[model samples]
Target chain A: MRVALDILIWVLFAFVIIGAIPVAAGAYQFLLIPFHSFKNHYSKARPHLPRVAVLLPAWNEGAVIGNSIERLVKLSYPAGRLRIYVVDDASTDDTPDVVLGKAAKYPGMVFHLRRQKGGEGKAHTLNHGITHLLADDWMEALLIMDADVIYREDSLRRMTSHLGDPKVGAVTAYIAEGSADPNYLTRFIAFEYVAAQKASRRAQNVLGALACLAGGAQLHSRENLLAIGGRIDTSSLAEDTFTTFNTQLGGRKVVFEPHAVVLAEEPGSIGALWKQRLRWARGNVQLTQRFHKVWFRPSKVHRLGSISFGLFWFTTFLLPVAMILSSIGLIGLYFLERELASTVFRVSWFLSACTYVFLTLYTIFLDGPTGRRSWREALLFPGIISLLVMIMAFAPGSLDHWLPGLFGLQVTEVGQEIWTLSVYAWLSLSMVAAWLVKKVESTRIGRMLSPLLIYFVGYGALLCAITFDSYIKEFQGAAQVWDKTEKTGRVAA
Target chain B: MSGVHRPGVVRAERVTGVSALTGLDQAELSQGEATDRALTDEALWREIAHNRRAELRLVPEALLALLVVAGLIILREVYFR
Candidate 1:
């Protein structure tokens, strides 16, 4: 019995180490980001403008479609070379009428492609337009974008120029959450984009393995599109990611153009954000299973199967699992060997604290305007309580000393032990808090409380909770329904 | 290429008499020529120079961030100990 207990303890430690690996890998990815300036594909890119077709998939986007069409017409690309194809997905709104009006105003430049049957999903809608565009040779390159995204004047031109390199398959722009008056949720999203797109994508560029192209701003060369079955993958919820992987697997480079900016309206409330992110999280789960054979098996054809890429992918996909496992490990250790558990907890969280500080600071430095706007969200990304835990982890008795003093109470041994145990359980407890944040958003008093709950639980934790929910849904074989994030024309150029 | 006849595509009015390959008409040929002229070797070099400058600017900022992180680690080790 003693020997068996010892082995169980060792296994718990192994789980803790497993959880720490991803955090270290994430920091390592950030370290590689600075190397992007040296190891980018800029030299091979030249000034080349192909005849571009902008495919806009619309489903009840009448409120934003007119303005979107107007913006496309005013883009800084050559008017003769650019054409807008609004693929109306049988929208019951005034989308068709608005698009037809634009088509009349900008003849030959703006075309309305109506689909009689609709609600199939974005991929099917895109494929409809793709079939029409590929039938003729007029479209040398295709730009697939959402109806509500406002592209910067030179964004398309920059994306097209990258296609000058025949070796390059696709280009994706940095999508910034540009709600005219951003609330707490949008601010968090803005910071998240800064970290995900501006920092992580740059790192991926250096590593030469992009995970996904932005759905709002993906530009693909005609030859490359045709090479990958002449249509978008309608099988997965993450069609953009499917296309991205297929493009790279077929031996062509997919580049992220940071200079090319596109503004998009993100979910403003917790309930809305949950629905939108659940779809994405579920899509990622599907993609992981679909490409199970490809992980960690390096291929000469593509880097999708490379060890670094696989680590990045699996770490993100299984982060919630890692968190739960790590918490279990620490708590088990505390029961069996208290002193060792304390030592391990301190060492592990010290590394986590260091990583959090460096990553948050470096992300702020990545984009000037976004950094300025969302710096507070970036700082409190892990939540106020988690940040305190980080501080306590590294500086062992500091919180115990200061927190009790702040409350004007003496810290007893029993209180200290309870606090220690609570800290150990916080890794998993944070996710519970995050789950409550979503639940609270739907209540009568939730509108007032949800935003406050998000701050206390942390947006990162909320995302992790959603991902955890995705695992449950996928396990139960829940029906994959495409939930459209409703957009109010909140984005300004 | 002359007209739209695809299934489910209700309305598409395409401009005819233009080269499908080049996508330029007779009237727009001058405009295309001007665009081509603007994309000269010198212009390409100028853009490259701007990009290089931007990239060079990042090196110091990254180094500074690393230094600050290093300082933080030192503070934790010294003061917390």
Candidate 2:
């Protein structure tokens, strides 16, 4: 019986170590990102701009459609060369009218096509637009853009600059959250985009395999598009991912152009963010289902089979599930035996913490001047990662003893396993506090306190809660449909 | 409306359209259902196999797990005993 019990403890300990693999791998990847700066692959600039068609898919996007059209009009590309196609997906609102208004003003430059029966989804709408564009082969390339995303004046030029390379199939730009006075949720998204796009995607680029092109800011060469079937896959929730993989599967490179920045309005509320992230999470799960063969036995023909891409993609979909299970298992083991569990937990955490510290410094270094200025955010990153690791390792309720003592309150539960749910729930208020302080930032106190809360719990714990919920939903195989994030046109041009 | 026990009959409707710009008729192309790649039992099993294979490839991860577990065992032997 004692031997059996020992075996059980060992098994649980193994689970904890296995679960930390994703986090360790993730930190390692971030650490490697900065090294890519020295190895630059420079492609010569094109002598002249390619004739490009911008495909905008809209469904009930009346709020930001006009602004989007205006932004497209102001793009640095030649008006004679670039054509904007606004494909209205049977929007019940005034979306068609707005496009028609723009079409009337721009005449031949801007065109409108409406899908008679709508809700066919973004991929189908894009296909409809592609069919229209294919009728005239005058366009050399196409840009698949979301209606709410606004490209900076030079962003289009930068994104297409890489298309000069004959081997490059598609180029994706960084999509930054663009609310002028962003709330806490948007601010978190802002920091996340910097890490994901500016850091991670750049790292992937060094390996010649990018994970996925941003659906909002993808530019595909006309030849490359036709090579991998003219239409986007309508069956998958992640049509963009399918397109990205297909582009690579057809023996072409999809490059991430970090200089090209597109401003997009992300969801502002937790509920909205949850729905959006759930759809994204489910799409990733579906991608794994669809491309299991690609990962299992990657052929030389399929460039998406690279180790870097596979590691990022699989960990993204599976880590949260593993973390939750390992955490619970650790808690159970702790209840059975105390010192044995503590020693193992501390050792594992020490290794994870060192990785986190290295990753945080590397991320800040890669981020350049702006990142350095926001050192507060960078400093909080290690703490955030450590706290998350602790929570996932079933941090004892005694951990809260530190917090209560610091706040001068009595601790209620000692040495009990504290489920992170309550901690996250209570900590979510920092998001509110950050938003409130930001709103009142004209005052002295607001200016001093807002950035701290914004970086600490507002960005950190709130994001974890949303991510944890997404993992739970995906694990349960919950029915997921694309939930359009509401855009209020608060983003500046 | 009174109903009796009778053979159930189902009716189907066909819809088609021609694009004004491209002049291409839909026929069955647009109307037909997209490929149903719904996660099947076979596909799920295949995915499980794929993940298992992936685990075999993760030698470093396996080593990390073993080392950590071994540490705990040693700690138990040294201190608790």
Candidate 3:
């Protein structure tokens, strides 16, 4: 009975941690500088005649869906062969009209439809489209996308050809900046995305563990998708991620084609980005519960990577809270052995210095070849990477209304009001206290420390570690999920 | 992992072959649906067997066994090592 109980706990632990792979992946991609050049090999490559459709999911996105449709219909592939379908979820806006305009211009090239009554969300809308597709008789593969995602003419062709490999279940395309003008946050996200979509996901494909396809530009077989379920969960906000991993559950692969690039707008404001991240975080916490059993299957190498994904974040999420309290205790001990305090500070500074230098070199290399950042920008990469995560952790409402969605039906949890500001008032206050103490304490070590360390050590270091571990895991095909930090970008084009 | 259900059911045995394949990797092409049966005669099966004989090499499990041992050692250190 005791042995059985131990096994049960192990299984439970495995399930909880497996989905954590993606979160750690985001962090990993952020930290690691890649040595290899990332480019599209499939852009110019053709494949044996494979039927493909560009399936677009739109939700009240009248403003941008037209641009997306016009852009998609103009793709350079064989006009008669390639298909486009846009399914609009119940929209109060002129979204349907915009889709209809494009449908009229392209005639057979673009297919437009509205969601049926009782449709819950994007997932339901997609399900309706998948079932309602006229080309089901001819279409072999489906390219799932959002309303806002605009693909280059060659993007569709490159993504579809990769699906020819039986081991590859889905292909997620890379996101590049579409417009030249971008805010600092958007540029940061774009560069961050390139690092992830290329450096990390490619490495995962090398190992056969490519994680989830990006919702913006995912390509897969109609048969494989139908096998999972006809549609994503419209009831929830994170249909893309849910659908991606669920496909893996059916014994299919998820991949990234970095060269099949799509340009997307970044979220405009930090607050807007935060709300987007919350949706992702809630979805991830929810999915972690959904796919808990996948980890216990002994035959799958994915289970191992999945667990590492979770463990890394669980450490990060739990560690900062633990470390801050521990540091307080350590400081009290400093009275007894201030020498230990001296040593600890010195070690931290040395580690921080070494890590920053290593990261700067990688950024310089990436910047030199691709003009990813200006010289001054690349020079500030490490400081910004750490500073951003630290401030983000203390950002309002991050963990405010997570429990209800996170715990699902087992716990009756409630989400926060839209635009609920000041959610992190208390946590931020706590952070301020830690910072003040470290600042005022004229003790040997605290005096030498920078205010930046409080931000980095208390928050950024933990997130950086989490991102690194996940990026490596996902790059290697681990399906574990970390939340996407939704920038102020529209999903509909 | 299981019994073969039928010739083209569990794994679709490629019947028709594209005589001159395009950018599709040749190794993956055998799994594609070809309309012609005579194209996939015994010789092609033998070819697929040669190409698909092995999978990506995996690290030996012995290292994993040692990791488990090290985990045990670490646990012991925390308790009674």
TM-score of chain A of each: 0.99, 0.84, 0.66
- Per-residue lDDT of A1-493 in model 3, one digit per residue for the tens? 9787556544433432332333344335433212112222232222423556778877667767788888876664445445788887766778788888888888877887777562365566677778876333556677778777678766775565556566556778877645446654454455456445554565555444445567777777766776776666654456777777677766777766655678887664433444454455455555555666654343363432454344433453343344343344334334434455334433332333333333334433332333345343333434443333222333222333343457662322223321121221222233444435344434556544533343333323323333333334434654433233332335333
* C-alpha lDDT of all candidate models, in order: 0.85, 0.66, 0.50
Q: Between the candidate structures 1 and 2, which one is better when assessed by lDDT?
A: 1
Worst 10 residues of 1 chain A by lDDT: A42-51
lDDT string, candidate 1, A360-469, tens digits: 88888888788898888888888888889889987877896888899899978888788888888888999999888788788889889887777878898999999999
**C-alpha lDDT (0 to 100) for residue A377 of candidate 2:** 57
The candidate scoring highest on lDDT is 1
**Model 3, position B25: C-alpha lDDT score:** 33
Calculate DockQ per candidate and list them: 0.18, 0.01, 0.03
Candidate 3 Cα errors over 4 Å, as ranges: A1-49, A116-119, A234-236, A295-298, A301-337, A359-493, B1-81
| Best first by DockQ, ranked | 1, 3, 2
Clashes of each: 0, 0, 29
Runs of candidate 1 exceeding 4 Å displacement: B1-45
**Maximum-TM-score candidate:** 1
lDDT per residue for candidate 3 within B12-50, as digits (tens), equals 233545332223334424432441221233433343332
Worst 10 residues of 3 chain A by lDDT: A417-426
